[model samples]
Target: MKKTILIVEDEDILREIVKDYLLNGGYEVLEAADGNEALSLFEEHEVHLVILDIMLPEVDGWSVCRRIRKSSNVPIIMLTARSDEDDTLLGFELGADDYVTKPYSPQILLARVKRLIESRYSTKHRKAAEDALASCGIDVHFPSRTVRLDGEMIRLTHTEFEILTYLMQNPGIIITREQLIMKVWGYEFTGDDRTVNSHIRNLRHKLGMKANLIVTVIRSGYKFEAKR
Candidate 1:
């Protein structure tokens, strides 16, 4: 799919020039003569990036940038005729990804657009791959009290979950059954090691092929070990 760039410039010739360069670069271009049109177009389409001019009628570029930042993290490059430092600073504070002064080469602007879009997409894809790998082995989310094994969700009872969470937290250290009951069921409980044994059996069953991650010590109890 082609990436879309919204060009919000009030100047007719500049807009046409930038749009031509972007189009030739194999990107889909959207033209907005002013800030109001820019906002409207942004709301209507899937705009991957924005090229905004600071001077406009109805609304200024800064206001447009502020409004876009409230909803989207889409890359934005602000264009201005003035090379004022304050304007550049304000654009950055408003979340503009890049800034270009007037008379910039159309080819240079296109290069900036390509870099910003590539950067945003690369970061998104990297994060996605990391998230997927997070579930590849035994993955636990403590806040949600959920566990995933080999990319599949495993349902566990409250006690079973607590037992698994504990072993996982202390991987490579064998935990005695008495210690497990004391921690999971609390010190006040009177249950024996059989109680811990029952929960472990069911937890291992739910874990399927990954059950070897929980290794049993001969005279002691069990510990979690990551697959080599």
Candidate 2:
């Protein structure tokens, strides 16, 4: 079955270009000129992934991302013209799976879409594992993808959940940022180490007192300490 992708961009030419590339890449493509329409289409369609632009009419991409995230973990790759680090960070913070700066290769964008869709479907079986990790009042249920700290349910984004899962799956072993990116975000991700750091920071903050479980190994990477 061909995966469906929603392309939300205000620019007509760019949207058509992306749609063309995605079509050529064997995807079912949907187009929206603004965030409002994007949200409408997202709600109405069974979209496998989203390619969203930051600047839009009626509603901005950030709001759209947030709205979609409230109900779905569908992969979202943000498109932005801004080169600022803050912009990229904000996108991740809003639960975006990835981001691409403007003037990007359409082929690269299509690759990202393919990777994200594949990753999403590939992990569906993970929720059926029925295995779990529990220690020091922090409990993670792999099947349910739920976390609890001292009996209190903790909310975590998809990225955060994956990072915590990978860390706990290999306790006491130092996992490099590169490894985390490859395992959690897939190989096509072009973001740097700071991207992993940002997600780790958010994950740790949510873990609160249990945050120490994720230990930073200077000059190397991070480790999930089984005890400390």
Candidate 3:
């Protein structure tokens, strides 16, 4: 079955262009001119991915992204005219899977959409290799995608979970920001090192006392050290 992609943009021309390209790329496309309509379509359809514009009528894209993230981990790629690094970081912080600045090539957008969808679906059937990783009073369970520190369950976002899992999987080894981006967000990801730093910061805060397990290595990256 062809995967469905939701395109939410207030700009009619841009929305049509994206819809055309995605349809050409063999995806079933749904179009929404505003955030409210986008959310309505999202709730009604089995959308596999979303291409959302930050500025929209009624509700904004950030609100839409946050609303969707509250329940579904559906892949979202944000489209914004803003070139500011802060905007990009904010989009990621809001649980967006990717971001594309305005004047972006439709082909590149389609490629990112395809990559994210593929990555999301490919992992859906993966069985847990090692069910759990326990160290320093923190336990991470792969099957349930849950984490516990000192026997208290900790809530982590999808990105945070992946970052922690990757670090825990390679204890004592220095994992660079670039490596984390590639592994956690996939090789197609184009964000800078700040993205990794942001997630690491959030992960550490959530880890609390166990946060020290993720040690920063000066200019390099970070290492997860299990308590001896």
Candidate 4:
């Protein structure tokens, strides 16, 4: 089945340009002039991925992302004209899978769309095959896509969930930032270390008492080691 991509941009030219690219790439394209329309379409369709602009009319991208995350783990790539690190971190904190700045290449944007869609579906397959991490009191329920610490449910954004799962899958082994980016983002990461660090920080904050399982290796990367 051809994946569906929702494009939420107030700019007419940019929206159509991305739509043209995604359509040419053999994916179904949905256009939303504002966040309200984006949310309506998302609720009505089985959208595979979303390319959402940070600026919109009637509503904004951040609200749209937060609302969608309440019920689904869909991949969301945030678009913004600003290059501020805080905005980027905020996007990740809200469960965005990727972030792209404006004045970017349409081809590169298309590539990111494809990669996120592919990663989401492929992970579904893997999750179905084998699931759950019951070690160290923190558990991941893959089928329902939920995590719990000692019986209390923990809410995590899609990216944070994936990152924690990857670390838990290889306890005691250091996973470089490059490796985490590849495994979760499903591509060679050209972004700086700050990107991964921001996600990890959010993940640890969410994990609370169980956060100690994730250890940052000095000058290396991160590892998950449960101390019994």
All candidates' lDDT scores? 0.77, 0.86, 0.85, 0.87
TM-score of each: 0.56, 0.85, 0.82, 0.88
* Residue pairs clashing, model 1: none
| Deviation of model 2 at 193, angstroms | 3.2
Give the per-residue lDDT of model 4 (tens digit) for 110-172.
Answer: 888877766566544554447667778898888667899888988776688789989988989
Candidate 1 structure quality by residue, lDDT tens digits, 1-228: 899999999999989999999999999999999999999999999999999999999999999999997777677888999877667767755666567888788987887787766644544333333332232287875544457876676755445666787887787899988787666644343334544566677678888888888888988989988666
Top candidate, metric TM-score: 4
Query: In model 2, which range of ten residues has the least summed lDDT?
Result: 121-130
lDDT of 2 at 176: 88
Q: Write one digit per residue (lDDT tens) for candidate 2, span 67-153.
A: 998888778899999999889999988888789999999988887787776755655553344467887788988655678999998
Two-way lDDT contest, 3 vs 4, winner: 4
Best by lDDT: 4
Kindly report the root-mean-square deviation of model 2 from the true structure over all alpha carbons.
Answer: 2.8
Model 1: residues with Cα > 4 Å off, grouped in runs = 123-228
Question: In order, what is each prediction's RMSD in angstroms?
Answer: 19.5, 2.8, 2.9, 2.3
